[model samples]
Target: MKKFKKLFAATVISLAMLVAAGCGDQPTNEDQGDADNGGGDEVVTETPGDVGDAEITLEFWNGFTGPDGEDIAKIIAEFNNLHEGEIAIRTQTMPWDNFYDQYRTVVTAGEAPDIAIMHLDSIAGYARYDLLTPLDDLAADIGLEDDDFIPEVWDAGVYEGHRYGIPLDVHPLTLFYNVDLLEAAGYSEPPTTYDELVEMSLAVQEATDGDAWGIAMPVFWPSNMIFYSSLMSHGGDSVSEDGLTPLYNTEIGYEALQKMVDLVYEHEVSPSDVQADGEVTLFRQGNSAFHINGIWMIAGFEQQDGLNFAAAPVPTFGDQEAVWAGSHNFVLPKQNDEDPERLEASMKFIQFVSENSLQWAKAGQVPATYSVLESDEFKALEHQYNASQQNFVFPPSTPFYGDAWGPTGPAVDEAMLGQLTPQEALERAAREGEENARDAAEN
Candidate 1:
């Protein structure tokens, strides 16, 4: 152990000296063009650091404050212990609601952490504002090739032509069913079709004598994601090919949304006006036999005593199969005073996390890497592996996605509450999307 520590120390010192020597050529902010992208032709040379030589400490910020946060913290602790004097990570956990605001404020003030975990959909926005470093070269050095990851997840890191993020895991919305309830309803398996889902839901209600409903409808924020996924399952898309206009106003979209409304109002198998958390809570309390939520809820549900739940891909509501999904990515915040050593350390940590992502999968996220997903260890994870292989529909690449996403829940809620017809609700949602697009284009 002493010999290993000495060698690791030597490696750290050698790399530090090399970086110090190269710093003389790094450009000052005044002369730096597009400073946010690590301006100037600063060359970086990577030297593999020996284990147990963690001398450099990198700050990391993430919004994983739930049960997953403990898993992430444990992983980081392992990384620190393994690298000892070569690399150390200092992490700050925060609630996701305030994370972006804090990140933006710090980034604008040049106080950004060396690394941050961000949602894949939000990458384009930060990249557009030059707030993140393009990882093409660094990624190559870390051996993060496209072959290692799912094509869709790997491609999600790209903005325009440059890659800005490295995906960590995928969390897709899937169907969660109460196993006992399904059996009581005479369903040997979960529903595979919309009609089957409705029928089973109705049966569940009848079997329980109104003690529990079929499903709890989500009517808040990302409830739109479910609606959009349903629309796409029917061969409908919410955005135009150019991503500058909304296409959910079409007849196909209306039919898709109408199906959701009928589940609540017509079939009466689902409760309307329930918020996102309320849906999960209802399912947890055994008030609903089926729930549509992200894979992240798996760990929590597994802990619910007597819940007897299982997960499956969201049923095919239309001619195609699609489900709302998103990925978490590790990104380096663009820094004007870029240091090669710190950058290299950051990438090394990310690579370490990616390589040992089975620990992450245990937290209920689908590993972003194909090999990890196919591993015996991951395959044992049950529903996540199957759900990850399904057709996942992500938000279109756009800097203004948040703006457009905001209007969908209200519109979906309106339709579910009978305040407007499915057609009118879709039209309102489309108008909001178009207005957001116009604003984004103008700005």
Candidate 2:
């Protein structure tokens, strides 16, 4: 595995260097003189070839730096073996923060990879910059339709009127419960509603005699995600349709955030000062009965010795059921010069991964492809299947959506820390978010 990764990394570096050199020397359309006059150097461009006629190597970039990386590597290996001399995919893995920071720089320099794995929320941002190629025609060529994917994830790939990504997998927030703790509290199953959640949590606290709590509510990390789900459940929208206005500061928003705050303060079911990942630690250590986190944590939780845990969809905490989810998407970066054969190969690779995403599910994600999700093999995975069935709420699709929602985390943190009331925190967040959105739009 290490050898394969090293080889792929070297190939990526070599390809990138060659591309940079080509970009630096290539003449622009205006710089080219009359072709027949022989006044300028002859420009030779590679014409589109049949996919199987010549071996094509594609550069792929992604930020799957955890256990998930290993799973994807396996899938890539399978694809490479199947294509053998026809096509090869070389990958370069980096941290997500670095991926986001460096992609635009590389794309602007005309040295972007042939393929990239993007997050659903990030598709619009890159599309807005014209850094991504529209995938609608390519998708149709490969027989990939919207009906083949989860509706929310499929729609997330579209920016303006064009599709820039192909749905891969969805990872949603779920309820993780320690089986022993729940049983000790006289509960045989996880809670399905807000009242039961609170009731069970309090009972667990009483049973544990304060040594273990009912829940541990963190003030950071997933707190923001939980808030989003709650906001949706309360029938609140994160932003206006135009994506320029913050809409999560109304009465519904207050009810959403206040409910989370109450878990720590009023109900006393959770600790007041749990920091980021504190809830996870508490659940793993059997110090808490319930922990709300993303399904991505399943692999790590399964590795803990002597820990008995199970997962379920997050219980409804408001007027409706909703869960925060995000997806990984396959995207094609806009190239300085496009090659049809390479593009065709890249699409084929994407289709293979999407179809075989059950392997991805083993890495603790819900396959976004409808056929994969409905397969008996996938349905057998209780946790992932259950989480996939939730009414998922995705981030708004807009180039400036990130900026529009930037203040939400700190706002939720303030409320959780009791430094400000839910109403006060959301008001401040909405005011700042709107300003940020306006500034980003202008830029």
Best by TM-score: 2
Residue pairs clashing, model 2: none
Q: Could you give me the TM-score of model 2 versus the true structure?
A: 0.87
Q: Residue by residue across 115-207, what tens digits does model 1's lDDT show?
A: 998776667777877889999999999788898886676776888889999999877777899989999988889998899989999999999
Q: Could you give candidate 2's per-residue lDDT for residues 1-443 as a string of tens digits?
A: 00100000000000010122121111111111101111222211222222243388788887666767678888887887778778877777765545655677788889988999877766776787788999989999999978777776787778889999898887777899989989998999899888999999999988988888988987876677788878877777777766678888999999999999999999999999887668878888989998887888788888889889888889888977787777778999999999998899999999999889999998889888879988999989887877776777665567656565657878889899999999999899889878876866665
On lDDT, the candidate that comes out on top is 2
Model 2, stretches more than 4 Å misplaced? 1-54
Clashing pairs in 1: 53-85, 53-86, 54-84, 54-85, 54-86, 54-87, 55-85, 55-86
Per-candidate total of colliding backbone pairs = 8, 0
